[model samples]
Target: MSQFLTQLGDAATAVEAFLAECLAEQQANGTPPRLAEALRHAVLAGGKRFRPFLVFESAKLFGVTREAALPAAAALECIHCYSLVHDDLPAMDNDELRRGRPTVWKAYDEWTAILVGDALQAFAFELISEPGRHEDAEVRAGLTHTLAVASGAIGMVGGQMLDLDAGRLPEQPAATIADIMRLQSMKTGCLITAACEMGAILGRATASDKAALKTYGEHLGSAFQISDDLLDAEGTAADVGKATGKDAAAGKATLIGLLGIPEAREHLDRSIDAATAALHAFGTKAEPLIEAARHMGRRGS
Candidate 1:
């Protein structure tokens, strides 16, 4: 467990350094000063960087070096940070804090926050599409295409739209467990799945290997969301680094609200089991991923 945490921390630190370099290069290339600052504020705020870790670990399974995997990992992190920036908008989640600091919109102005998300989203594509990311054009293209779909209307954005609609339509019937699952899958699962898929693409893994990683990502994503919901249900804002109990307060549809804490915990455990099970094809090489799945179950925030 200590080794897994160390590895996770190391990945986070590497990606943070890479992202900082990317931002610096953009600024040097004539990005406006204020915009660059806002970008830094949004992207540099510390988080677990769990998605990037998936990319790194998945690529490592195929003997890909961390250097070879860093671009994709950083690109995925940009998308994630952009999502958080946009999600914190007053028009969205109305969040005032992120990573225990003032959110982008709260720290800056709304327009700046909007531009920060826009810039980060564009930068993510640029990073993935760069020829230097992979020698083969096809690999770069695959990464770009997968990332687009994952972050597009059919995935994260579409899922956010569904969540917003659910919150607005009080007259409609409550969302079923299936509905919640689908929403969560699109909103959160797609990017995570893409992180793993992008890693496979980077490593040029076999089709069966890619499929196994995808299964692991799918189950891991589910477990991640359930853990997040559990945190909201049971944690303090200080511990979580964001508002807590907002889901219930907003009458949002979540497995926790439907199943109660104990049942939701059981579901989370099953998800962790399934996630680790999916990595069976990789043998001991997938230890980090197995630990990652278990870590989801143990998350306190």
Candidate 2:
């Protein structure tokens, strides 16, 4: 467990360093001081950085070096941070805080927040496509395409659209477990799945190995959303680093709301088990990934 945590810390450090360099380069190129600063603020916000850890760990399966995987890992973090920025906009979830700091929209203005998301997303593609970072044209193209699909309308954005649609209808019936699962899969699962898939691309993983990592990500993503819902239901804003109970207040359909806390917890455990099981072929080397799944299940507790 200590070793797994240490790896996560190391992953976070590598990813952050790359992201800092990217932002610094943009600043040096005169990308506008405010825009660069906003990009840095949003991307550098402290978090567990779970997605990047998946990238690094999954790539390790194919003997890929950390430096080789850093660009893709940083790209994933950019997309993740961009989504958070847009999700916190007034037109979206309208949160006032994140990571225990004022949300981009709250810290700056809504327009700046919008631009920050846009710029970060563009930078994500730039980082993944850079020749020095990715080296191989084919692999870089694959990484670019994978990230595009994950963050596009068919994935995270589509899920957010569904979430918004769900709350917009006052007379709508409560969402079923299946409905909630689908939403969670797209909104949160897609990018996380992409992170693992990106690792496979970086390492030239075989079909079977890639499939296993993808499965691990799917279960892990579901567990992550379940854990998030649990935290929002029970945790304080200070501990959660954002407003809690917003989902319930918005009448958002979550596993907890549909299945109750105990059943939701059961489902979370099952997902975690499936996640760990998906990597069984990797044997002892899969410990970090297994620990990551367990960590997802225990986020709020």
Candidate 3:
């Protein structure tokens, strides 16, 4: 357990360093100094950075070294941070707090926050699509394509649209479990799955190995979002680093909202089990990824 924690910590530190380097490069390029500062504040505000850890661990399964995969991992982090900055906008969740601090829009202004998200998202593509990270052009293209789809309308953006509509239609017919799952899968699951699959792409894994990693990512993403729902349903704001109970307060659709807490927890356990089972193909080599899936399910426990 200590070793896993150490590895996760190391991955987080390495990702931060890559992020800093990118920021420094932009600063040197004479991007507006304030925009650069806002970008740093938005991207550097601490979070678990679990997505990049997923990338590195999944790539490790293919014997790919972390340094070789860091650019792709950093790309995913950029997308994730961009989403958060936009999610906190007045047009979105309108939260004043993020990572237990004032949100970007709160610290800066709404326009700056929007531009920060734009910059991070553009930078994400730049990180992956740039030359020299991958020897093969095909690999870089694949990573860029996957990240684009995951961040765009078919994935996170679509999910956000559904969530916004849900908030507006509080009195509308409640969504079924299938509907809720579909929404959550797009909103939160696709990007996560992208992170894991991108690792396979980075390592040039066999089809079977890639499939297994994708399956693990699917289950892990579901479990991760379910845990987030549970946290908002039961955890305090202090513990969660953001508003709690807002899902219910806004009448948004969630597994916990649709099935209730006990059943939701039961579903989360099933998802976690499926995630663990997906790693059976990797035997003992997948311990870190396995632990990561377990960690997702155990959030707020």
Best by lDDT: 1
lDDT digits (tens) for residues 1-301 of candidate 1 = 4777889899999999999998999899999999999999998888989899999999999999998899999999999999999999999999998768999999989999999999999999999888766889989999999999999999999999999989986686879999999999999999999999998998899999999999999999999999999887788545545554777678777788789889999999999999999999899999999998998888866
- Candidate 3 least-lDDT 10 residues: 236-245
Could you tell which candidate, 1 or 3, scores higher by lDDT? 1
Error of 3 at 265 (Å): 1.7
| Alpha-carbon TM-score of each model against the true structure | 0.95, 0.93, 0.93
- Residues 153-224, model 3: lDDT tens digits: 999999889878878855767788888898889999999999999999998988998899999999999999
RMSD of each: 2.6, 2.8, 2.7
User: Which sections of candidate 3 miss by over 4 Å?
Assistant: 1-3, 169-171, 236-244
1 against 2, candidate with superior lDDT: 1
Backbone clashes in each candidate structure, one number apiece? 0, 0, 0
- 43-144: candidate 2 lDDT, tens digit per residue: 998787888999999999889998899899999999999999999998888899997899999999999999999988998999999888877999999999
Best by TM-score: 1
